[model samples]
Target: MSLDAADGTESADRLGWAWPDLPPGELGAPSPMFAVRHAEAPLAPLTLPSGDRIRAIARYEDIRTVMAHSATSRNLRYEGAPRVTKGLSIEDDPASMLNMDSPEHTRLRRILSGTFTPRQIEGWRPRVREIAGELVDTVAAASGPVDLVEAFAFPLPSLVICELMGVPAADQSRFRHWTELFLSTGDASAEDRVSAALDFAGYAAELIATHRERPGDDLIDVLVQARDDDDRLTEDELVALVFGLILAGHETTASQITRGALRLLSHPERWAALVDDPGLTPAVVEEILRYDGPGGYGMLRRMTERVELSGGVVEAGEAVFLLLPAGNMDPDVFPEPESFEVTRFDGTGDRAHGPHLSFGHGPHYCLGANLARMELQVAFETLATRLPSLHLAAPATTVPWIGEALIHRPVSVPVSV
Candidate 1:
């Protein structure tokens, strides 16, 4: 299955992408998109629904090229950029560090740097271990079966983030609801989304006020103190930034943990192998991230100027979507890329994992990668040790994935204690 090139030659028409109107969750499944773009043509021009043009960087090298390119700007304020969401003006505003270009991005990102450093994230390891252990115990005490997503995956990251942000444990339920509404793409009620954002913002504002009077050692307190000490970020920016971090940090990590567990548990051999050798846990974590990480692709970045990619020219402002899963399966890079190898990169052949773009690449790589890794490493080690015989209670294909959600997740992974 190949697409005919515009040049009317078979050689030029090397790729054929059978991308269709499937729901978001289903898109990650083995689709023609992978078979065509990754197997046939690594670089291909794709016409999106809105008649806008963008190129899909499917091959590992191509994906890295796009992510590492300077011409690409994460700023959404560009003329023809993908709309992240309709609710917030930040979707198109170049204010968020994730949406800004060089100098401004550098300035805003620096504000977040001192706090989210590797040292700070690594310091949270003990707490992450404690949270993972506590959650596992809670589930163990609960009798027969447990929905891992609800019981463990969802809360561990959420609680850790709340603690870090100085958000109270009691407020997480409402915070979780609002974060869901913001990231949802299905038929979510307009009122639900807007109302949640307003309430969440008001709550953040109140939290900031409280922190100002009584400063603490949490990230939120740090931000507020920074705001006071240096005229760096405004009150609104602080609110938005914290809100963004809370949502981004928790949601993606939760989803990945849930999905990764299911991915391994469904294959008992993999689960057993990890249990047999706990050291393989880290490699397994990386493989899971590469295999089924949350985030459809990295953030939507726009072309700052006219640029040529894959023998096609993307005019300035056009947005490019780098599908990470496709890149992970590229044959040129990873031999038999689809197969899950626990020790995938331990002195293998000439090919390495080739930088799974799951955490993304370049300066905008996930700030919480270390924290996420710590949480995941602890998660697998503990779960595998405790529930050695743990297997998916339900069939793999029957497991439901969260729909139209930014993070890929199983709705409820049922497991017997």
Candidate 2:
């Protein structure tokens, strides 16, 4: 039954259901309720906490079609468009690439594309590994049980993104506070969410002004030059890009790193596997992306035109939610879908399965995926090599999760090395 959003209670998206019980039970599993939804409602209607009605697609193939098909568009800026949260969602931002459709989306993405290409991110790998090494060293040197989230996961990406933006290391804690409010859906009021956006954008604006006067060699400086020298993007667009990058660039990856470590450590054998053969780190990374990808429900899109699917027909003006993690759970594509095998993506023998939809397909595919992969690879590899005895100090069920916003992660992963 749909609760009136007018009242205070609202419905949760898919991830909310899975998160309560999500440290991959036994053979690395997805939630039973989540699996049931994949089977029964792979394509069904959904309502956001904002009371916006939309269609949710969970099957592997259907999600790919929605992402690739021309009929489904991400332009959520139209009149009476659906809202993803009670307050201003990324879709509501006119300058955000998340809210724009092609040509405009293409233009904004192109400006930053040169920096995030796989080759470009690879060039930054040495520095990333250096950062990860230092973090793991701290965990190793610690005398007592360490909270991985505090000691390793969170700071690794926070430091990396700060370095990229040329922001002072001192400001990260403030950014983290603003980001939590900005992403809040159920746990925050509309005013609080809006306030967070204003604060975040205001800071970005100040940085833009600073870069204009004296340029530095970082992303913010690059963006400032782009706006001043080439006029490639507007003032608002530049701010939106910087704000989005700062928040999205590291937050999700941090969540993934903590969650991945939790998943491996929960199963001692799995942890040993990675420690035994670091060569398997790549495969383990893919499995983690597939089994327990970060964030709520998934990507949201609007139907610009009606499209037919195996389940039913989606009409124009209707919004479609692509449940990326749910799509990754499809048994038809990934054999014995409930269990998460580290080598599931190995593409060897009967283990050969379809590519995981953790990252959306087509043009809207995650721009920072390569950087994220490298971060995960380096983080885990360093953990295995540096702290081979890393094990959960507490039960997985006891781990605390944070993020009242779109992307939720364990607040702490108590571990002993």
Candidate 3:
């Protein structure tokens, strides 16, 4: 199977529409075509801006297989490895665990995993709760329509991740600017994106230096200590790892917060339901991850061996895109996949509804999932409790959506209390 789609090596009719470029349906749900593809073409080829074609594994089971499969490699360091975009994307960083597989990836993941475990994350609950409450108070007091993205959504996670990583509080505004460009697709130019990313890497290096000078009580300190003690990962890898965490730590969570608030606010009953019962916060957060999670472009991998999927057979050395959002939308796995129900996931934790792949599956599952859930739960609970009358400052239609990106986040989420 040739990957070239630019010179007509692959038939145009077989390709799914170029992704990360498609607009989300109402309220930031995945494109309807993703749901349709689960049945019509579970294994679909998608054309990239580079004109290379990668197979999209759209069904829930197929996606799970790809993600958990040992034979599949996420090694994007190969020459001409399928570029997610035309510029220097996160995938281009070979030192990052995101682009590695097996032992190397496993090692780095373990080093950072201990900090993000459910129990460890729970330890930070008080701080996360405090941050959420303070932000809500600020948003509640602000007159006129508040840009939730600026005032609440982005900041809450930004602060949490920064604090967790031991970033200086004063540098957060500049940090936001770099991350904003790093996450942008069409809004920022390729050169601009590269510059921002480089600047970010430099800043991360400085943080590492600071952590080295005075071993503090944060993740960067832990990583710096790990590197000096055991020679775990190289200095460059250290910087990339920290940089990767900073970007992954908050970008999607911020997006989820923005979309989650908008979704609940759009439906007054749902907002009231959460307001009436704070216990419903966890379930609502899960549903938000299911309905509007940062799984837009999905993960990219190449099969090291031929494998049969729920959809079809994938050949060796071929690139495949695991569509996590589509799997979350799988009607078989999640009944009424289109509906936005807070209680969609029962508290029993049964297999009926599922372990949504929004957080992903297997070895590479999201490291910050626990922390992210904590942030979202606290954010939503705080909002509903503090501002029950919260509604979109403008129309839901007026909410700006940035479509062309690896993840989905609104340009600005506006609201009023």
- TM-score winner among the candidates? 3
Which candidate, 1 or 3, has the higher TM-score? 3
Per-prediction TM-score to the true structure, in the order listed: 0.87, 0.91, 0.92
lDDT of 2 by residue, 1-417 (tens): 111222112212333422222222332345444465565666665655566767778777888888998777887777887776876788877889877778898998898899899888999999999999988889899999999988999899999999988777888888888987877766446788889899999998887888787788898988888888999999999999989898987788888998899889988999999999998888899888888876556877888788887767778888887778778778788877767688776621124555787667888878888888888899999999988999999988777665345676677899998
lDDT tens readout by residue for model 3, 1-417: 122212232322222223532335675667666665777778877665445667788898888888888888987767767876667887888788888887999889989888988899989989988988888888888878899988888888889988999987778788777877775555346778899999999999999998888887899988998899989989989999888888877778888888888888888899889999888888888888887867456878889999998799999988888878888889989888889998876532235646888888888888888888888888888888888888888888777766555566678878888
- What is the lDDT of every predicted structure here? 0.69, 0.78, 0.79
Question: Mind sharing the TM-score for model 1?
Answer: 0.87
Q: Candidate 1 overall Cα lDDT vs. reference?
A: 0.69
Error of 2 at 310 (Å): 1.4
Cα lDDT for residue 297, model 3?
Answer: 62
- List the pairs of residues colliding in candidate 3: none
Question: Which residue pairs collide, candidate 1?
Answer: 5-13
lDDT of 3: 0.79
Candidate 3 local Cα displacement, residue 2, angstroms = 23
- The number of the candidate with the highest lDDT is 3
Residue 93 C-alpha lDDT in model 1: 38
